[model samples]
Target: MENKAINSAYQYAFIGAGNMAQAMMAGLIRQGLAPARIIASTKTVASSEKLTASFGVKAVQDNSLCLDADTIILAVKPQVLKAVLNEIDRQKLQEKLVITVIAGIPAAFYYDLIGSRLRLVRLMPNTPSLIEAGMTGAFAGENCSADDRETAKTLLQGIGQCLWVQTEQGIDYVNAISGSGPAYFYYFIQCIAKKGEALGLSYEDAETLAIQTALGTSQLCLEQSDGNPERLQSLIDQVTSKGGTTIEAIDSFKRNNLSAIVDEAIQACYDRALAIGETYTK
Candidate 1:
């Protein structure tokens, strides 16, 4: 299971061809990765047929068939991951680079299930990946070589932005922020729309307004920040002028301890991620 030399051109196999798996597959194909080099093993024949029809990739219901590829992507659910791993050929798995997008599982958990020599990378990618605008966090196992990291980065970048964290626990921090982060924004948008509805605007009009505002605001922050945190704060300050309507809303948020509430929510998410990992360890 020790790190071995891998070919620059990889043949990838996905264990479960779900939404996230399909996203990655789409990105890879869009970036010129040959669909013939990709294989997906889904849970059902219908799912397999759907993938083949949509992506022109080979698809099957047999998990064992995936081991023929040099790189394996574990895109299955956390609950079913153990079963999937158990069903795969362990010896073959040891020689391949395995990248897992299943959340709340540590690299050690995989090593324990497979072998310590297994080359593994744990990844957390958000839903935006479907549209190739994902934010992904990656952590490599100790046994992985520099090539393994690069291979992962190359494949991931096709989908969107990729960040490599130094520690495995950093993956949990990622889970708190970007992993569960999309739902938080959606909830905020929903709340805004609901408020507008209460204020006499139609639900459709209110939701459209909120959605556009959110999209424009995100674009503004990204363009203006230029990777500077302080610049982002400055952007916020620019809109919250003294006694302005924006300031009124900002004051109400502050008065209600919105910052602390968000902090608690993120912490809760982080804790739950760690707890899930702990469960697997035990």
Candidate 2:
């Protein structure tokens, strides 16, 4: 990649202006993009006002006026997408790369909705985006040019990590992993916190301990991860002495089939994502 591929075409018009959009816009602005270059539009006048005041970006009430933005982001809820995109003619929504962070809907849906030949990038980004630590998985439509995908990658990278997949189905896989993975980790920590509380720790201490453990584990993975993850797990197992507390805990988890349970839960998420796309057209 050349230095010229840095960043291009500001004037991003965020259609939803909701929490995710705000977080992404925040990440972009934090990366040195000017606030004057952003345009956020939401259905609620108050939302528009709040964003404009908070970010110093231009705001608009209607989708029609949001067209002034060079790159258009469809950030509304999945349920309202049909009605929202219905309001804007497909022909007019063309030219610029249309990126959708909304979950469940495939990139091709946007392409088909806006008529084929329009550039589209569909992304599945989690709530962590609010803090700029988000992990996002993006996929480009067949019609999307390489430049358009790179632009989308550059824009999304401002907030968090991103990786592209050849098939849009990868977004559903992403929905199972990083997108929904955060909540899974949180739920696990929540249970751990509760367990700590049962062991006589104060509620705050229990929560803190559980969260710190999770954070430290994640950081370890980030810092020491090699191509093979089982090696690290083996190292962990070695550190956890034989017939020790760690072994006891590991035995309990294995007895309860924790791995299978987590796998099944992820499959449930993946199935749900596919089902949503199947029903969208109906």
Candidate 3:
């Protein structure tokens, strides 16, 4: 493998100035990467101005400038990705590392449109990245060098923890798990808050309790996860005695097939991701 300096020295260009892009840029800047080393493109002049002002990175309207960058982060939405790909000079990307945060599009789809020689990394980042507590899943294509993978991992780690998978297909699983996982937590938190409200707590109090409980539980899990394989299950079992209230709730969830419902929901997300990939690949 080449030295770390080789990978870390590359210039970054973001093709979209959206929330995820901004989150990544902010994280990089916070982690001591020079802001001037990064650049971004936005749709409108006003947006470009705002991005430049907000992040101190060069912002431009022309997407072609990104072709000159050593690393191009495709932060655009899936719907606009086709247009962006059509406009860019794919040949210019042959020597560059292209990292994408766009959901539902596989690395092979990009290679099919561009040349297969392009080094590519596909990523799925959740919303919590804005606050630096997110989880991202990354997968690199066959042509991607070890240095390219290292660079991608370093950039993503600035925002949150990143998990790398061997197969490109694993990206779709990441999409189903962590990418859409935050919304599942949000939905459950909403239900818990509502239940609290129904039980006579004020809305604000209920919401605070619900959110804080989530944070505390996650922290507890993190603290207990030091090589204890069954730590999470152990924690759950500890909370549920033979005839306790927790056991009653667990039994109710079991009777109602909650686990099956969650599995079905995750499967639905995975299926939709496959359908979207099929739509764009053709």
Candidate 4:
């Protein structure tokens, strides 16, 4: 944990004091960003008070106070983001750098809402962000300057790995992949544990085995990987014998068109993200 501060000059305002905001604020503070430079504004006084007490940052119930901050981060849910935006006076935001983490919303949508150009960044971060091991995909609006992108990266890096893409559509793809990926892994782990229990193992023992195996495999991949996809596949191949049980399982997956099924699932998720954006835009 490096204690070096990032862009310490700018004042940061988070519009929602929920788990995602708390996770990001915790990471920033852990990395030595001054708490006094940040403020969180929740819809309720009680929620604002609780966040202030927990994080030692300024908290307010009024969303308009965000206008005074140098950077504004919209952390509200997608369903309510429009209401929050409508509440704000757009004239006050003309010069502000706005970053949004509301899932499925596009930078273009925000641009249309404001009816003017300003620095905006649309980001998609996953559940893993709570542990500071998250992957965030970001896309800066066309009018955003290089410095604006760098600022967005610096803050996002405090919490996890960050990537900037050339196109806004890239963030939608990220929403389908990394954004929903943890749930897929969890479901797979659940299925494995259930099968183990069917084989006479106690539920707890089966879960332990399933989770440990998943964890061990991830660790092994991390150790052997040089940032190459082929390296991971090679490691998997090493443990799969030509006619062993591992091969049997591989064959079964292939017979069931597992790859196609997974691809379709990801495509469906991506389609939904696009649809959500359209819904908000309308």
Q: Candidate 4 lDDT, tens digit per residue, 53-135?
A: 88889999889988889889999887888788898898778689998888987776787777567789988998889999888
State each model's C-alpha RMSD to the native: 3.7, 1.8, 2.4, 2.0
Top lDDT hit: 1
4-72, model 2: which lDDT tens digit per residue?
A: 233545668888988889888887787778888888877787877888889999888878777877789
On residues 1-282, what C-alpha lDDT tens digit does candidate 1 reach at each position? 222333437799999888999999887787777898899998888887888899999999899999999889999889988998898788889889999999998888889888889999999999998888999999999999998887888778767888899999999999999989999999999999999999999999999999999999998887778877788879989888887799899889999999999999999999999899999999
Better of 2 and 4 by TM-score: 2
Q: Can you give the TM-score per candidate against the true fold?
A: 0.95, 0.95, 0.94, 0.94
Candidate 2, 278: how far from true, in Å? 0.2
Ranking by lDDT: 1, 3, 4, 2
Better of 2 and 3 by lDDT: 3
Give the per-residue lDDT of model 3 (tens digit) for 1-282: 322332446689999989999999998887677778888989999999899889898899999997877799999978888789889888887678999999888777888888879899999999999999989999988998888888897788767888898998898999899999999999999999999999999988999999999999989988887667687789889789996889999999999999999999999999999998888777
Worst 10-residue lDDT window, candidate 3? 1-10
Query: Model-by-model lDDT, in order?
Result: 0.89, 0.83, 0.88, 0.86
Kindly report which residue stretches of model 2 are placed more than 4 angstroms away from their true locations once superposed.
Answer: 1-9
